[model samples]
Target: MTVHPSVTDLMRRAEDAELARRAHHDALTGLPTRLLLTQTLERVLARRVTHAPIALLLIDLDNFKQVNEFLGHDTGDAVLLQAAQRLVAATRAQDTVARLGGDEFLVLCENTNAAGAGMVAERILHALQHPADGHGAEARVTGSIGIATAAQHHGPTDLLREASAAMRLSKSRGGNQTTLFDLRLGGEAGRLLDIETALREGLERDELVLHYQPIHTLADGSLKGVEALVRWNRPEHGLVPPDDFIPIAEDTGLIVPLGEWVLNEALRQLSTWKRAGVVPANFTISVNLSPVQLLQAGLVDLIDGTIAEHGLTHEDLVLEMTETALILDRSTMMDTVSALAETGASLAIDDFGTGYSSLSYLRYLPAKQLKVDRSFVAGLTTDPRDAALVAAVVRLAHEFGMTCVAEGVETPEQLEHLRLLGCDLAQGYFLGRPATAEVLTRSWAPAGVN
Candidate 1:
């Protein structure tokens, strides 16, 4: 049957419109191309002779590469399409969304100030966290967003760069969030840069040191162990906390070397403490392990060699690792833990219950202790749910035959509560703040012994 002339004309017009639309949009998601977004922004900026405020947003999907690597590129493409759809839904019609490249998108919010841009960024983050349709499979995508406003000094490219920098800042602070570029942080940023430079030279300059935080047994309130916490004694920056510089180290691929330094320093210190009679020879010396360090080749050999050099038993050492890291690199983590345990060293899951890892992973890990995350313990004084959760974790740890240590025990009430819950150990400012190795040795040394 022949179609009516009017219907054929209308159909032809719709086909032409679809072709034009496809010409300027991403084939998979139908989002505008970067060229289209840039052209649109140029038109908007061109009209602003008197200078209207505008913001640029850089959106990055965290660990998208890993998803693609493990789940295949088809899955990755689907995730990107879902992300594009959510972004389009969250954004205003006036706002432009563009697929800049793989796993990165750009949003140009016209006639909007920095605060307005930030609100849009938050909306994008929320959208990403929303469940996505995975064609018979369920999954969630979380992302990080960075915002920067156009300044007199910034061209379109500079605005893009600033937004990228802001995104990097969000990733450095631990991903799945948003950050806005602030001129007020110029000084702080410079200082952080300087610290990063100094940290690079820290090992060679012999400026990094280890401080000891005492871990006490809850039953007798006696010191059973001390965790070796690394500190950077920058000649110019004074003392730099781990929270301030550790992320930088991890980002810059410095954690592998820095972690090695921590291990050597802690082991030497443990030897000294034994020689000085500051603690029992067989007492455990716990040291924090970064994921990078665990994944490093020859980690087993490194730890074994160190233990052999110090003539210390494996039982005399404990390695603390966060559950987040464990989840990120499980196979390597399990291998490293097994190797450490083979050398008689024990492993402890630090900051437990803070991330999404299931408790079933506990069976495969060589951990002897599980330290409850501080955030949970902090609310134990008032929140019954928090109290019950903490108690349940402790019970789980006990059932697994793993000792439970409640961290952030900063109050008598917290301590008394933990004692009632039968927590195996407690560590925080309340028990005794972290101290310099010398001070720690002196404080815990038996009278007239050293």
Candidate 2:
């Protein structure tokens, strides 16, 4: 008995419909996939009126990669499944919850404005705070959400991109929060992207240059050391300040490579100067250390290799770090400091008295010097409290058998006051502005000691 032609056609149609359904839904979490999310967004936007609004949210799980790294992928899958359920529970029936791939979920809320979207985001955040079962173990995760509303003629792709940008901004601001997409933020996000690209190119093209600022002895006015400051001489931008690019590099993890370049270049310059007899045998070079660089694996090895390559002793290099770096990750920071100390490199706390007021770190940190922040030094001649603080810091540094340096002494009175306070070294415009290696060598090391 042969089947009818119409029956055969009907079976084929049914099979096609089932496959389409499966393709639109995620297999792991059973939620709509990115394809369905786009379709739903278009449908909702078409039906939305002037008064009615639709909101699209991009939810990124913070530190989710850590979960996959620490636990197995199977456990990560279980957590995602649990997270999908919680998101579904937090939304209204009309809302579409979607799995937009690893650690990212999307929510489409129809007939909702910013306020309604915010309420949903808050609920989802609260729900996610509870521990989820990841292969019989508990796993906790926080989310950063970026919200975009259907306003100003935004298409589905635009909404998604803007929401993702806002989510990144939230993550940059320490994550586990909600952010709404604004036109200004969109521009800022684009600028940051451009900066990251330019910075990478800058490294490849050798656009980065180091300027040396002379640190002077407070008593004899003799040269103490030079701090290497990285500057970007961009073809388009023309000398971008470290203040502008350094933060972006740190945020994008470009600091790891950028810092390595700075270290190599600084040490190379020092070696050249030493060989040319442009600096005294005891002359030192200071390079600022980004917090990210300190946490890098084999940082100690990298430092040692760079010093050895330049034929410079570790004692001739000073690694200056801000106090904030110390508080970022105490254990890792302590280990890094200890390792550097073992290598015989001098460690100096930069911008002291401005961050992490705990003095306990002073007792344990292997730091050999403290750089008093300019804020205190700027007011030393006028503000009694500032003068007292500077004195106290100097006293503390002395008690710990460490040297104290004052930053930004711009006036004669300020310099006089710092000397009276027993400050060992001072660096500022009043002393000597940051200049090229050639200029510094001509001015400070005119006699080029052999």
Candidate 3:
């Protein structure tokens, strides 16, 4: 007779088997856990007798925070699950897919070369660009992919580092694309890493500051509002411009916190002016929104909360977003822009008519103001094409019940051109250089407003 197991023993063994499976799988997406992926990488590394190189592909959802923050976390979870399925569908059957935590996935291809890796990454990017659910409006997120192929002298840690660096490069370039890791990226990545660390410390030390640029009534040069611009005051580097450091912040995910601080501080300054009666009730302060910040979490609440906390109304704030960025994920962005508009705050499309103009969005965008790009204004008096475009923009904005503001007005002629074109507001060096709050309020703000 054969030895037979009891019912109790059978149940216990099945339970243990399930627990082991769970340990190696992600609870949410059912993809391989990072632990399992590592073990798979190691096994492939050690057993490799062939000359074919293995490739590691990292997938990170760009602006995923928008889903979690604007839409509910439940929606974000469903989107992640959808994303995991898409990753699996896009890869080879033999490839191992893993969830490296929160909107980031990794694939290990045992026998794939760099070219094959590129193909797979392209497919993955395409798959992720679709809506998560059947509803075209939901799950509107895209992937930023990074590829790293095994070389003659590399280990598991090196592979991870290269893949991560490539992903950072993709994100720094505004995401929704793929980047391959190479020797050139190594130094730039290292330098950016240093800046990222220093910037984090700088935030803690409160080294970032805001300067206000006056928005003027083009006809009379009277102040209407001020736009807040961020600047870094590094200890050793003197003053660092945003162009030099913002990409690092975007790549490292520091823009969210940095943006939050700017919102709060700008509102606080406006509140101070309000209390002193130096500002009219209609006076407003505009804050620039980063593309990353636009898609990050709690943007609406953060704006609404900060405004209320600072004893200001929604009408006192003017939020500006780049026209190009606004149209990136049209459906998702339109939703966020709608929610923000619902809060009664004014919205302006910044840098309007920059090459990425999407005419379709203008009709649907809830924004009531458009800032004519300085590029056109720079050529206003000289180029008839530029003059005609500015004139048409002003007329178009008025037709839609919107205000048209012209930026980068440097000369009296430009100001006169804007005034003649019926441009509502103007900002630039000639209008007023960006100045400290104390200086702007004391110097530009009228002693009294009727």
What lDDT score belongs to each candidate, Candidate 1 first?
0.77, 0.83, 0.81
lDDT, residue 248, model 1: 61
- The residue-by-residue lDDT of candidate 3 on 306-396, one tens digit each, is 9989999999999999865564334445667898999898999888876334365577788889999999999999999999989988998
Misplaced by over 4 Å in model 2 are: 1-124, 127-168, 171-176, 179-185
Cα RMSD (Å) per model? 15.0, 14.4, 11.2
* The candidate that achieves the highest TM-score relative to the unseen native structure: 3
Q: List the residue pairs that clash in candidate 3.
A: none
TM-score of each: 0.63, 0.66, 0.68
**Which candidate has the highest lDDT of all?**
2
Superposition-based RMSD of candidate 2 using all C-alpha atoms, in angstroms: 14.4
- Model 1, global lDDT: 0.77
For candidate 1, the per-residue lDDT at 370 reads 93
lDDT-sorted candidate list, best first? 2, 3, 1
Name the weakest run of 10 consecutive residues (lDDT summed) in model 3.
324-333
Kindly report which residue stretches of model 3 are placed more than 4 angstroms away from their true locations once superposed: 1-88, 92-164, 168-186, 444-450
Per-residue lDDT of candidate 2, residues 11-81 (tens digit) = 99999887677558766778887768888888777777776888999898886656654654556677878
